[model samples]
Target: MGKEFRNQLMKVQKQFPQIIKEVRGKGLLNAVELNSKALSPISAYDVCLKLKDRGILAKPTHDTIIRLTPPLSMSSEDLQEAPKALHALLEHDLPEMKKQKPETVSGTVPNVCDRCGRNLYG
Candidate 1:
């Protein structure tokens, strides 16, 4: 099941070489490394946010890698949807996201808390 899921994800990577740097993993634990240069102002967290909006929950690691660990009980059919959603996002939404400007921060631009968006440096 893990191999099948990784293969499906590899297909998505092939479809978007500019965005996906590599796809690697063992068992149900996998990571998608995105081209940081290609993503620019958009981080992996931003991509995860989009994925979340599409009903997928993924985590960002090292700012450019997305960690995917589906539950063990997930059926192969349901698991297949992950790659499809990723493909759709890269194909349709990414282009639009690229066009948008990064959010501008006023003043000193302190680092904010990820979960609550509070000013971490304050």
Candidate 2:
């Protein structure tokens, strides 16, 4: 898993040098940030879809960051393919995400869980 993630991360770094500011983390947990609003959740969603299409699953957190948490034992090829997929997604989707108005962007999680909309203040 570590090797796979590393390979993919390196590929992404190489492919999108202008946008990728830095990548951090280890094992199956990793994150890469872009230079601009590309880090936004809306853009991450499109990137996530691109990852999904490549058989690598990922998601965004905080609506301004994308995180990669593949199985701890994914193969090298799978890892290598992730960035390629994400690149394609970013090229097409990032612009659209940037075009959206700030008000149009939705929150990542609801204020409360569906089953417990109330706060847990006891």
Candidate 3:
């Protein structure tokens, strides 16, 4: 899982430089960083909301760090779908996310993930 995630996101970085800082972690527990410099200075919280709209459930760890924890029972279908969502987010949403006012974004856990319809907070 880790290798695949790294490969997929790294491919994005190569295609779209300075957007994704890194993709790394142990197993399905991983993190991704964004390059705010690539666009306008972007808040991690804003990126999180953009990712949510893409059907990814990531939370900000800091101003630029996003922690991603896929469920242990996550199926191969979800595993495949997640990266595509992330890629699309990086490709399309980063620009739109850049346009949003920083104060408008929030880090609160979403009620239900757009991907699996799972409640993000218990």
How high is each candidate's TM-score? 0.83, 0.60, 0.71
lDDT of 3: 0.71
User: Candidate 3: TM-score?
Assistant: 0.71
Lowest-scoring 10 consecutive residues by lDDT in candidate 1? 101-110
Better of 2 and 3 by lDDT: 3
lDDT, candidate 3, residue 2? 66
Best by lDDT: 1
Candidate 1 residue 108 C-alpha distance from true site, Å: 13
Residue range 69-91, candidate 2, lDDT tens digits: 76656666656666767776667
lDDT of each residue in 1-122, candidate 1, tens digit only: 99999999999988899889999999999999999878876778888988988888999986699999999999989999889889988888887887795744545544885666878777
| Candidate 1, position 109, lDDT | 45
Question: After TM-score superposition, what is the CA distance of residue 24 in candidate 3 from its true location, in Å?
Answer: 1.2
Model 1, C-alpha of 36: deviation from truth (Å): 0.6
Quality of model 1 by C-alpha lDDT: 0.87
Query: Which one wins by TM-score: 1 or 3?
Result: 1
State each model's CA lDDT, in order: 0.87, 0.64, 0.71
Candidate numbers sorted by TM-score from highest down: 1, 3, 2
Q: Which stretches of candidate 1 lie over 4 Å from their true place?
A: 103-122
